[model samples]
Every structure is written in structure tokens, then in C-alpha cells.
Target: MGVMNELIDPPGIGTLTRILTESAPMVEWKQTAATASLLGDLNLRARTDLVADALVADISTGPVPGYTTASASFRAALAAPKFTGWVLWPVSEAAVTLALASDAAEDFNDCLALLAELTPRLTGEFAVRRLLARDMDRALAAILTWTAHPDEHVRRLASEGTRPYLPWAVRVPALVRRPEATLPILTALYRDPSEYVRRSVANHLNDLARHAPDAVVDTARHWLAAADRNTGWVVRHGLRTLIKKGHPGALALFGFPPASVAVSGPRLDQEILTVPGELTFAFEISNTGTRDVRLAVDYLIHYRKANGSQSAKVFKISTLTLAPGESRSISKRHAFRQMTTRVHHPGLHALELQINGAAHGRTEFVLEMA
Candidate 1:
């Protein structure tokens, strides 16, 4: 079975339906159960949609008066021990959908309250997007408040909800256009005590870096001025993409000086290989400058795609300090394994060495199917 099916299978949905009935006698369990029974034939997204639609229909038809009342009962139902972990994800999705529907008509305060209460159990990050689209300032206000909330999950929501490129969630164009709006929220949680919150803060800043590198670099400089270990971790993670790109500011932040190195002796173990095989290579790095320098060593493989085009993937090798006239030998083995996400085609592949973002020492190998 696929991952989504495993997460919310038939048995789990049945249990969730039963819990709803027990928590709110006013709900028409018969209809909800019937809807859930048909979910087995649907894909993961479809199943989520069907379950949510059924619940909304049942709540609208049953004795529950309005969106707020129905949301309250659903939140209470989810409190049962059985609805823990990923199983509650679908329920949260459904509840958030309902809240968004109500929020569209200007009945949002109750929905926001429901999300704050429900997010600790399951994320309301997806639902919060509707608010952002309808009214950005209002959403920003709510998100800023969440950054200070006692619950780590809610504080995380503040960052996760505002991410310009949040996976599986709709993009916020305003934030994409003006990423600075997020600076307030990020600054508020810069030194958040919870690792969970700090990680989300890093991811949010990373998204911003893609659009506004200078802004992110400036923020990194400010955050690094008096950073604790945890806050420093966030800055490092936030600067990963910039570091990979060899941005001078990002490299300087990590103490990697200008590139003053020599690369030589590039060798590939095999000139030809097959799928499910390994490609090993080695090279040497020598410091050619007058002073010691920190080197961030990385390599890139220009993979030939099935379309006869090439794409590059960067891999980190190691980081070390090299004094003048010092040299070090480094080696790496890359396995060309078949993966569900990628299809391999017979073609020529090239590898290159990178030191602090400067490229050198190129070599090539051929790949074929067995």
C-alpha cells in the first residue's frame, strides 16, 4: 500500500468516525460511516477530500447549529486517545477546511480560536492560508500573536504558516512579493527556546533567502551577533542554500575565507558503469595562499537526464582548515541506485570539484542499463 493509505487506512477512519459519534450524539454517525466506507477506492488526496466533505455535510444537516459549534464538537472528539499522531491529520485537514469556509464570510474569529486550540493536536497551518489570502494584515497580526503563544506547535505555526513556498500548501503571493512582512514574525521567534519553533524559523528564513538573499544575509548578521548554540544552529540552517551557492556573505558568516586553493589529480575508478552501481573518485586540495584558510569542500555531478539534457546535483564532502603549502587527499563514492523518484538513462556523466564555491578538476564516466 502507498504511504497515505498506511497513514489513514479503513480501520483508522472507522475508529475516527466512531469517536465523533461518541463525542457528539447530535452527529448523524450513519451518514459519516457510509462516506468513510467508500474511501478505500480513493487516492490519498481524494480520501481526505471525501472525508472532509462528508463531515461538513453531516454537521450542516445534523443538530449542530453553526460552524463554531460543529468545530467545537470535532475538536472535543479528537481529544480521545485513539486519535493520536498522523491519524489525526485528516481530521485536522477537514476541520480547517470547514473553518475556512466560515471565515470567507467574515466569521473568522471563532475559526481562528478553533485553530489555536486544535493546532497543538494537529496542525492548522494549512487552514491559516485562507486567512492570509482574504486579509494579509489580519493574518499577519494573528501569526505574530501565535509566535508568542505558550504551545510550541502554535509558535511553529507562526513561521510555518507564513512560509512563501510551503510544501502542499498554497503560496502566499504577497509574502513572495514582500518577504519583509515575515521579518517581524521571524525576529520575534529568533531565539525561541523550543527547538521545534527554531527549526521552523530557519525554514521560513530559508524560503525568504531564495527571493531576498541580501535581506536574509542581513538578518543572519544580526542574529549571529549574540547567538546561543540553538540560535546559531538556526542561522546555519537558514544560510544553507546561500552557502551552497558560494555566496560571499554566507561563506564569511561561517568563517570560510576567500578561495585560495589548488585542485589536482582528479580520477574516476570506472570509465563505464551500470545502474545500481557505484562511481568512486579522488582528488587533492592544496592551500596556495599566504595564510591559513577554512575550506568547504563539495562536489557536483552533472547527470544526463533521459531527455539528453544535463542537471547538476551538489554533494558535501568535508570541511577543514588548510595552512599554506598544506595539501589533503579526499575521496568519495556515489551510488547510482534506482529510486522511485528518479529514472536512469544510459548517458555520460561529469563530476567536478568545488572549494568554497569555486569549481575545478573535471572528469566524466558513462552509465548504462544492465
Candidate 2:
């Protein structure tokens, strides 16, 4: 029954007070105070149902400005509870965004239309991703559409929002288990006109590289072959994991390769002391190149932990500039104790020689029981 003040929060509450007093002279002060109190309670813990009911009532009775604030506050409140479990909320972009942000992980699903339209402008892309994480099939479908959205923000969200292990969001096992499923989405964004979107794509691909190095390497290869200037850097960035693991495709992309491989000894005396156990390495390095070249030679050891899983640790025991026809023998004593480093069980441990930047040769050695 009165004019509404459209003020952004941190609102000038006093302005609303004056507007309410003057616009609705017949309106009781108590009612106005109640409205103000409801607005203020946004920062507190309140019941989701109660807040939703109050907001719906406000939206139905008040002017548009009041309706907007009430809706936003109500959605914010709902986000704290099981909003995702109840999928029947009056779907507005604001309410949908908030519901996605909720910690509730029951039967919630996103409306594709709203998701396509709103995902770009939504502030908390990571929060929205949590809801999607529960349903990869749905999330991928919606993200595919959003990837082509005209808005850069929305396009960016299509990639950033779908990380395999996005923080605070539900972990999408599909991405981690089978990163290949994400290739379609990544492919679409690879050549996107928007650098922002492309960068997100690169990061997403890199995320995939953690679990699926081959998949990322393939994608990077295609991008690099095309030599698309817009996405060249993105391809490079996306290859980080593969490069780190000494994948040949990745190293070759950068025009570098290891020319030799050799090993020194199987002696136990030179082993380094590890509290729980000690590690000994015998390596033979060879220079296959004709020119004398400097190389960063080291071995990567994968040790088993108490939990029966393996972890990789790198040791840089030697670096040398070798003659074109020279060979060298090297031994490294790696000691380990406690569970701090990778645990070595009674199983075979993986060993690899990294020559220059390439993984030259790989072998398995038994980790004898102590």
C-alpha cells in the first residue's frame, strides 16, 4: 500500500525508514519495523522454511523492490539448509543460484534454461557446481549449452564450474574416473573467441590431466597442431601435468628429448637412511646424442605406503654435461623412515630414469620386507 525504496545492501536503512514513513502514512510503525528486522536477519542463522514462507509472503504483498530484497534474503537463508532436497521452489534465477549454493545434496537438479541464462552472471560459480557434481549427466548437458553462451562470464563458468575436484563443491567422480567424457565440452571451448573462456578450458583440461594424462595429451596435441594463436598458451598450460610426468608427447611438443640412459650399481652401502627403512638406487646413464649436452639426470621412485597405495618421490642426485659418446654409472642412497614419504610395502616399486626432461627408461624393483 506504499512506495518501496530500492536500496542495495549494505543498505541505508534510514533511507528506507524515511521512505516507508512518508509513503505509507497509515501503515503502522510496528509493521515497518518487522520488515526491517526481517531484512536485517539475513546475516544470522534462521530456519529455511520460515524464511522461505516469509519471503513468499513479502513477494506477494509488497512492491517490487521489497519483493526483490525478500527473495534474495530468503534464497540466501535457504542456502544454509536442505534447499537442494526440495526441488519445488518457485524457480527464479536468484532462487536457483542460491539453491545450488546450498549444502543440501539430495535430489536437486538444475533447470537447463535458467542454468544457461544465469550461470554466467552468478557470483559463486564454484557453489553452483556443487549441485551439478551430484549429477554429472545433467551438469555436462547444461554446461555444453552454456559453453556457447554469448556472455563471457557464463562461458567461463561452463569450464571453471566443472573441475573434477572443485573445492567446496561435490566431487564429480565422472570427471575423475573418466575425463574423456569432458572432451566435448573442452573441445568446444578450445577455440572460443573469448580468452577468458579459453583459459578456463585450459585449466579444466589440466585438471583432467591429473587422472588422465593420455586424454589431456591428445587434446593438447590437437590444439598445438592447429597452432591457433588464441589457444596456443592454453594448450601449453593444459600440458603441465603431462610435462611433469615426463610424458613423451608433452616433452616432444616443447621440442626436447632425452638422448641417453644408464645405471651404476645395485650396492646397498650407498643407500640413504630412511627412519623406517632405507632406499638404494643403481642407475646407468648413456648419452645417445652426438653433441656434448648438459642433462638433469635423476630417478623417480614410487614407494608403497601402509595403505597399499603408491606415491612418487623424485631425487636429484646427479646432474652432468656428458660427452657425445660417453657413459656414466651412478648410485643413489635414498633413505626413508616413518610414513612421511611414500610407504614401501613388500610389493614391487616403480623406478624411472628422467634424462634431461624425458622419461627414458622405466623398471620395477622389489621392496623387500624389513
Candidate 3:
């Protein structure tokens, strides 16, 4: 709704300075004073790095102070009741930074524990990437235990922090290459009582689907076998990407089989669209099969890129079963606005129907920049 960077916009510098000073009385934090008023121009990740590096630099003067002082300072701050919120983003990062430097096994464990402790305030999700990058197995071995933690936040971290493609978090290349690595964690929590934890598990599965759809579908199958009331939502969300792409396994998992249907007129109300406006479009699907058939109807917007080529994005529309000779009409009002995620470039565009993973009824349009 607003500038995306403001979403992670931390507390004011004065607020951070005061909190740092008061939360960890054991540390001097000298370098904290000089951080420029330069934070506004930076996005969330850079802003976090700026503050964290300063905290690392200011930890302690002792020769081996990096890991020692920072961990101590973070622990001391944990003891203070007020050490929480978006400001903890940088604090967690600082702890991870210092821990990455140490060869001690305990430091790695402490770092993981520190992240879990810090997550309740503000996610240590971003910071934990350092540990994951350093040694994924070691980090995951420890993180697996978090699924059983009493706090749902910690359980969510166990899934979310290990996501193969966690947004705004650093990529764990190993996780991408080996999507199955985190499946055990997901397995443990898919039926979790807390919706917050299950939601993270769903997103984690969705991330895995980007790289390994088979593994994700299989995992979803396992989850289905042992489902709770919330498992349906989790499995559906986890399979979203695969469903959009028309992966048969995902489609079948959702009861949307290969549909024998005919599509007609994804006709646009206007063949030309002005920016910051709305386009109304409608389409119809009819059963072409003799027996009942289910359909997962989707739509694609082939957006024009800057170089005149097009990239398509799929959006879900609806799902239904059509009996022999039955027809259903669908209509939608799609808004075109300049959001941070996508830009509207004036050019030739197209819309199409995707029924059960098959493309049909393509209609062309033009986007005129307003």
C-alpha cells in the first residue's frame, strides 16, 4: 500500500541508540553513535547490514571480542524486557556475524539459540541465513529441534528460516539444490496446532515447489494422510505454484483432474487499457466430456517487458466440477496499477484462460501508459 522499504523500516536512530544503550549495559557500543542519517535511502536489507556492522564494530575492545562480546551483549539484551521489535533485526544480524567467525561448535549452537530467542521479538529469519550459508547441515540439525519448541514463533522459524527461497532473506544455495533437506521439519509441523506455524510450513513447501515439485507434492501427500483441520489450507497454499504451472500431481492432489472442457471468449471489455485503470474480462468453460469432470481454472497475463518481449504471470480464478453439457461463465475485474512488484510498460499484451493447466482462449490487448 505504501513504499515497500517502509515495511521493514526500523525504529528511529534515536530509538535504536537509546535501546541499544539501555538493553545491554555490559557493552560500550561506541561505533553506534556515528551511523549516518543515511539510512532512509537504503532498503531493508542494507539498513539491517548498516546497523549490524556498526554493532559488530562496537562490541568490545578485547582482542578476541567479536564473538565473545556480541553474544554476551545480545544475551544481556535478551535479559532486558524491552529489547524487541524491528530493531532486533540488526541485533540478530550482529550475533550471526560474530558467530560466523568462530570455529567453536558451541558458538554455532549459541547463535542458533540466540536467533530463536530473538525471533519472538522480530524474526531472526534474515540473520539465520548466515548460519545456513556457513553449514546448512549443522544449522538444520539444530533447527529440526525447534519444531517441538513451546513457542509457536520458534516453530515458525524452524520452517520459515529454512525456506529455500525466503523473500528478503539470503538464498541458501544448498537448500535450493536439495529441497528435501527441510522436509523433515515441515513433516513435523504440517499438522501443528498453531496456524502461524502451519502457515510457515505451507510457505516453506511452496518455496520447495519452485525447485522440486515432486518432492513438494509427495510431502503434501504425506501431510494429507495425517491431516488436521488446518491441513487443507496448508497443502493448498503449498501447492499453489505447482497448480499455477499445471503440474498434474499438484492438480490431482487438489481434485482438479485433466479437464475435458472448452473455453470461450476471455474477451476484454476494452482492447486498450490506460495505466492506473481497470480492465474487465470474462470467459466461459463448458464440459466436453461425457461424465463429470473437475476443473481448476486459471488465467495468465502476458505482460510486455521493456525489451518488447513478454513474461507471463498466472493467477488463480476458481475451481468447479462441470457435468455433461454444463457451462459456466466467469468474469473478473483486474486492476492495473504501478506497484513495487511490477511496472506497467506500454506495449502489446494478452490474456488467456488456463483450465486444468491447458491454455485456451487467448485474447490480445494493448496497455497505454497513463
**RMSD list, candidates in order:** 3.9, 10.1, 4.4
Candidate 1 residue-wise lDDT, 198-229, digit = tens: 99899999999998998998999998886877
Runs in model 1 with CA error above 4 Å?
Answer: 1-30, 62-68, 71-106, 164-180, 207-214, 241-247, 265-284, 327-343, 363-370
Query: What's the lDDT for all of these models?
Result: 0.80, 0.57, 0.84
Q: What would the per-residue lDDT of candidate 3 be over residues 68-99, giving only the tens digit for each residue?
A: 67776677667656677666888888888888
TM-scores of the models, in the given order?
A: 0.79, 0.56, 0.79
Off by over 4 Å in 2: 1-94, 97-124, 127-142, 191-196, 230-232, 256-269, 272-284, 288-298, 307-310, 315-352, 356-370
- What TM-score does structure 2 among the candidates reach? 0.56
Clashing residue pairs in candidate 1 (N, C-alpha, C atoms within 3 angstroms): none
Task: Answer with 1 or 2, whichever has the higher lDDT.
Answer: 1
- How displaced is residue 346 in candidate 1, in Å? 3.0
Clash total of candidate 1: 0
Candidate whose lDDT is highest: 3
What's the lDDT of the predicted structure labeled candidate 1?
A: 0.80
Off by over 4 Å in 3: 1-27, 33-47, 262-286, 315-318, 325-351, 361-370
Between prediction 1 and prediction 3, the one with superior lDDT is 3
